[model samples]
Target chain A: EAGVTQFPSHSVIEKGQTVTLRCDPISGHDNLYWYRRVMGKEIKFLLHFVKESKQDESGMPNNRFLAERTGGTYSTLKVQPAELEDSGVYFCASSLTGRHSYEQYFGPGTRLTVT
Target chain B: AQSVTQPDIHITVSEGASLELRCNYSYGATPYLFWYVQSPGQGLQLLLKYFSGDTLVQGIKGFEAEFKRSQSSFNLRKPSVHWSDAAEYFCAVGLAYSGGGADGLTFGKGTHLIIQP
Candidate 1:
């Protein structure tokens, strides 16, 4: 089985520009999650999706950040008017369940650089 | 809020030497602990996990971690370090036990391991 895959391995854009990161979870996986790690910081949770429904989104940094999972297949994270502080590695993970303590498979991550 | 702390920012070990990386966590209940390794240009890979029962759990790549409830710690260890072991190690914690699915993880800043040949 193929692991979680992410698009646009690296993204470079100017401040105020918009960027979208995509993630394709493993086949038959119902739980998808988003996390980001800023330089010199820990990886922080962004949000989670159980199929097409949002299970939890308390980790979203601000209003400019938005996440969506369509058709319960893949997910996208959009940062509108990205800021310099927004530059970091965005990671997507998926698991068979949405409860807790189960291992999550992670992607290579999308490195976003907002200048 | 759940959180993890890795006291060592970086560690250097000679090839074939024993290795240990410290991890401390603060959570309300019995924490679900995990250790993951990130190679250069790669995603995080699970090394091992501690949920219940055994306090010491073995994982892939000859890695192991001991969960100490008294210390509120889950530390990773290896009997002998290999050059390929040079990577960033992250300690994460989760709440509850989900056999079917897992929730979002709270990760530490990570420890960069340096293997000297």
Candidate 2:
């Protein structure tokens, strides 16, 4: 069983540019989550997906950020008009849906640098 | 809302020495606690978790954490530090929803562990 996997381990873009980060969860996992960690700051939750539907998105930072899980297979986080403050590591995690949902497995985060 | 605090920003321990990293949390009910480690160029890895029953939980890579309800703390410990143990350790609290699926986690700033040779 492969752990969660993310695309484009590192991304560098200018402010106001759009960037999309992708995550492929483990096979048969129904729960997916997104989290971000700015430099010297704690990792903060962004949103969560149960299959193709959004479970919770209260943690989303701003309107410019959007997350989607299509076909209940993978997830994508898009940051439009990215700002300098958006430079950080974005992590995606996944787990089962039942009693073991708390046990989340993370992916190698995508380090985004917005200059 | 739940929150986590790691008092130590960084810690240095000699190889083979004992290690302890402090973590404090604030939540209403019995919190779900977790400890995760992130090595250089690696993703966050779950070390251990405490939901109920046992206060002391053992995890991978010879790591263990004790959950103390009185102190509102869950501290990670290792009997002997290894060079490979040098990494960033994060203490987190998972919000349990009554509905079903797991919610997002609240994480601490993380403690950077330095292993001296």
Candidate 3:
């Protein structure tokens, strides 16, 4: 099985610009999650998707950030009016359904630099 | 709320030396614990996890972690350090919510291990 894959390994955008990061999870995995890490900070969860429906979005930092998983497949995270503080690595992960497993397969991550 | 703390920011260990990385968590109830390793420019990889039963857990790469309820700690250990072990290690706590799915993990700042050859 293929591991999670992300697009545009690195991205650079000016402040106030919109940026979108994509993630293609492993086939047949029903759980998808998004996390980000800022400079000198721990990786923090942004949201989770069980198929096309969002299961949990409590960790989302703000309304400017939006995530969608259409047709229960790939996911996209959009950041509008990006700020300098938004520069960090965004990771996507997937896992099998039913089990509360900690073994989440992660992608290479997209490094976003907002200037 | 659940939270994890890794007191050590960085650690340097010579090849063949023993290694230990400390992790502490704060939660009202018992929380699932995990250790993840991340190589340079890579995403986090699961090293091991502790849910119940045995307090000691073994993981890949000859890694192991001991969960101590008394200390509220779950520390990762390796008998011998390898050059490839040089990377960032993160400790996380999984919170169980009343809702269906569990809550996202709460991670520590991470400990960067430097293995000297």
User: In terms of DockQ, which candidate is strongest?
Assistant: 2
TM (B chain), model 2: 0.97
Candidate 2: tens digits of C-alpha lDDT, residues A7-43: 8899999999999999999999999999999998999
Computed on alpha carbons, the lDDT of every model, listed in order, comes to 0.91, 0.94, 0.90
The top-ranked prediction according to lDDT is 2
Ranking according to lDDT, highest score first: 2, 1, 3
Worst 10 residues of 2 chain B by lDDT: B93-102
lDDT of 3 by residue, A87-115 (tens): 99999988766545455778989999998
Consecutive 10-residue window with the lowest summed lDDT within model 3 chain B: B95-104
Cα lDDT tens digits, model 3, B67-103, are: 9998899999999998999999999987654444455
Off by over 4 Å in 1: A98-101, B97-101
Q: Candidate 1 has which clashing residue pairs, if any?
A: A97-B101, A98-B101
Residue B72 in candidate 2 has what lDDT? 96
Q: Rank the candidates by DockQ, best first.
A: 2, 1, 3
How far off is each candidate at the interface, as Cα RMSD in Å?
2.6, 0.7, 1.9
Q: Model 2: how far is B68 from its true place, Å? A: 0.8
User: How many Å off is the CA of B6 in candidate 2?
Assistant: 0.2
